[model samples]
Target: MRKAWALLALLGWLCGLAPAIAQVSLPADLTQRELVIGTRVAPPFSMKNAEGAWEGISIDLWRHLAERLGVRYRFEERDTVQALLDAVTTGQVDAAAAALTVTAARRQVMDFTQPFFATGLGVAVGRGGATAWLPVLRTFLSFGFLQGVLTLLGIALLVGTLIWLFERKHHEAYGGPPLRGFIAGAWWSAVAMTQAGAAQDGPRTLPGRILAVIWMVASVVTIAVFIAGITSALTTQRLQGVVRNVGDLRSIRVGAVSGSSTVDFLNAQTVGFESYGLPAQGLRALKAGRIDAFVYDRPLLAWTIQQDFPELEVLPITLDSQNYAIALPQDHPMRVALDVTLLDTLRSEWWTRTRLRYLGNDAAN
Candidate 1:
């Protein structure tokens, strides 16, 4: 009985030790050789300060991981995200430490650490003006406007037919050939809808006078309603601008970052978009009215807008959900170690402060 109890205790101890052992099993060379980490200038993820020192969310996270793992590493900056990712895939760099998004195509070529941040594609548009007239034009051409016109014409026809039946024989204004009488009555009704003095030329028959009085009062209400609808439409159009959601992007001049996940999404949806080299360039185009909308990563857009492009606003729209993770060479020996430290660092209080420092209240919890 004593031997069996000791054996059971030993089994439990070994089970507990397995995870710790696996976590520290980083290859011997990973610690000895200075690891090459690739990065690109993607604001809040990777960027150089005025002093020329590199710093950002991904950079901080990597530094934390390196400190914990006791590994020496050096950063190799690349001009574009694709170049950074390519460096990782080719083992030109041991890992990519930028805002690398994990996709199936990338995964097929290089491994990725568990995602550190979650975000989606967003649209950035100029705050106001430039496209203001577009909304007004759309309002006038809208189905509601056409429907209102049709309903008004129908009412005029009905009222004119009634007035002609009562007054065609008694009043010269309405007395004529059948078609002429109808036209005269219809013109009177339309005029009365806009002017109260039009009632003076109303039909002479008692029944005709009664119908005229009722229509005059009703016309007041109709005119009020019509003016209110037009006013409301113009106000709404001016306030909401031209684009309200993703569906509105189809007809507008759209811009996107070249070689980004946003471009992939726009292509998949069959949306024609002009590609810009960077988010700042795309935003500048939008501000200058060259592009109606600029689409890119939500967090990155928020960061850029807050930092350099205050004249712009990011629409409260999200598309193409994505996860940002560290890119690494295929089956990298340090991947497991990196993931362990990454998850721990992400779950710590320091990570919260780091994110808040860069993203303000926009930081994802």
Candidate 2:
């Protein structure tokens, strides 16, 4: 009775392990078939070279996977990411390779390999457009700048009033009707703050002279801080264009790729934007002053701008996090093997060098 019960337990263990074993197994004819792979032109991930040969990060990954599995495959180029994904869902292609971002909505229709790259959406702006004066005017009208100016004026008024009290009886420079005397004292205080020679004579009384000496030293520090504040405000305004964050998009004319996840995000935020067929089109519109800012994937924007659009720049800010991966048909037979090999490739030193070559020194970050 004990031996019979032990045999049953062993059989149950094998039954539980069947699915795991099946997942890791390759199809007998997979190596003999020529798989159809769909791709789109998303630079640095997948794009055609000058000679019309497809090459990029995602292409290289797919190529590596094909070689490792000993499978033959041919790439079918698609004009739009939506079309490529549609092909995968309808089983027209075995896989879709590009800088495909993984989103919950997309997951409902197709599957994805393990994420190989992670980044976020970034904004881009043109350098040739006329600098908008509204930002500068806003800077002057800003609370921080106005507060600094008002504080300086307040200090000058207090110092002038004190000087008038000390010198009203003796010093001709400050001796007059109350309003006139106050004005003269304030003028002298203003000149003293700038260290510029005052048109009037110095105070004569001991108390008045002592107060003047203290104010002169204090004004040196105060004026330095005041100038620094103005300089900082203007410099920051010059650097931060009309759009600084996603919230800033509401007030500015924004552009993004049509049918992209970025468009979905903008729609969710209720920020109105012009949609372009491609990022390059939006970038050109930005340069032509048709739009105030362009938003898209960070790595693609950086690479495109660095290679062709020297007059354009990507902002240091990110809008949303994204994960880049390979898209496959739902419950693809090769999913397990692809994930296993992709994880191994990503962990290799060759992958490190490949990323650095494409993404520069900040690739690790």
lDDT of 2 by residue, 164-222 (tens): 88889998878879998898888888888888885366678898899899999999999
Look at candidate 1 and give me any clashing residue pairs: none
- For model 1 the TM-score comes to 0.85
- Candidate 2: where are CA atoms >4 Å away? 1-23, 28-32, 132-138, 171-177, 199-201, 236-244, 360-362
Q: Model 1 Cα displacement at 241 (Å)?
A: 3.1
List TM-score per model, in order: 0.85, 0.84
Candidate 1 per-residue lDDT over residues 44-115, each given as its tens digit? 899999998889999998998898899999999998767777788789998888888888888999999999
Candidate of highest TM-score: 1
Off by over 4 Å in 1: 1-24, 195-198, 204-206, 222-234
Candidate 2 vs. true structure, TM-score: 0.84
